[model samples]
Target: MISGETTLDVRRRLPGVPAHVGIIMDGNGRWAAMRGLPRIEGHRRGLEALRGTVRAAIDFGLDYLTVYSFSMENWNRPIEEVADLMGLLKRFIRNDLGELHKSGVKVKVIGGRTDLKPDIRALLDEAEDLTRSNTRLTLIVAFNYGSRQEIAAAARALAEEVAAGRLKPSEINETLLSQRLDTAGVPDPDLIIRTSGEKRLSNFLMWQAAYSEFVFLPMHWPDFDRHAFETALAEFSARERRFGRVTAQGQNGKTKKI
Candidate 1:
């Protein structure tokens, strides 16, 4: 357990420890390829990394941890790989749900569900329902999620409301749109980390990441550990988040456009 003083010291040094953190778990296949092993091996090891990261998140006092588990684009992969991925998902939920709930971690899944198999959908719903009241941390799994599709769906819903004369077209705003998103009621991530040196968002949380701090790591997803997580948080702490306006230091010192 983290002592009070230790926690305070960490906070003092890493003041920017984000309340919500998002991760793009990339490089599984590449890692496996580099090792001359099947891609499934890398994915399997990545699952182990994820388990460790969840425990780390709870210890770090993070309120939300969002992971890009699967994407809408992932369906284009070989059918066998997809089946393996689905199997892993089922295995993780079946094996970890009870432990997660016991540790006060809530599981929240974001993404489209209409096309998912009934069993997969049921497992997701069961995870959420089982841990709805947990307060320690929320593990958001982005399965079959595409930022563009999410945005389009929200727009469609709002348009329907307008067509029904229940709302004005001009009444639409960022807040309204956000409420309709899969991540509705969740705080926007303050930091987004991508492994394997990837520097792009790749359609993950495109709209919600407008002001997020990004950390790209050269290590693959399977190698991500608590230390790596802390390193990213420390990097975030060292930077100033100005949002859109210049900081007071920036205003008084060398003026650089944001």
Candidate 2:
């Protein structure tokens, strides 16, 4: 939670605000270990941070916010920890779905759902169906998602099309591949923020984040709040995003192709 004074200092519609932002929430276990608390407690606190961050995103007038909630690799963790995570996911949807819907936050779950338990899949489906009409903020949850797997799946689908003579081998391109991914209609993220001071994507949105600006924060996920979110956005505002091209200022006030 952010203090009232800090909230007042942060502008709602600040300049250079990214239309779409992605986050990699990390360090739940470490935060708990540092305090001699159970890992589950840190995870519970992290959930609270997530709730605050979502509200912050809405207040900031963002169109899309993607969170790396759970990855395919996460299943490698201990059984108890994994179960705890699943429990938290269920709790989040059950407890917060109504509020999210009322606030015009549409939930979109990406990644594989075929392998998830039937009940879990049902909850995810319910969240998306109920809030499909929302327009204020699209909260993308990357559950059981792996960027390599997503890319491979896209390629496999395209290959099958070519094999069936429905598409030519030469017709396959970046746009077509992007359309085949789980985030087909969504635009790529403009900024990616990671908590816990970690400096990696961890197989999250590799293809879509080709040009996204990254802001790494030293604070753990449980400590993230509205103030932290605003701080990250402030950093993003200071960055000069030129994609792959050179800016006129970089070329001594003369525009030229690199």
- The Cα RMSD in angstroms, rounded to one decimal, for candidate 1 relative to the true structure is 2.9
- lDDT (Cα, tens digit) per residue for candidate 1, span 94-200: 99999999999999999999999999999999999999999889999999999999999999999999999999988999999999999999999999999999899
In angstroms, the error of model 2 at 172 is: 0.6
Error of 1 at 151 (Å): 0.3
Per-residue accuracy of model 2 over 1-258 as CA lDDT, tens digit each: 356544413543457888999999999999999999999999999999999999989888789999999999999999999999999999999999999999999999999999999999999999999999999899999999999999999999999999999999989899999999999999999999999988999999999999999999999999999999989999999988877887554546765545
Candidate 1: pairs in clash: none
Model 2, residue 225: C-alpha shift (Å):
0.8
lDDT of 2: 0.94
Error of 2 at 179 (Å): 0.1
The total of clashing pairs for model 2 equals 0
Misplaced by over 4 Å in model 2 are 1-14, 250-258
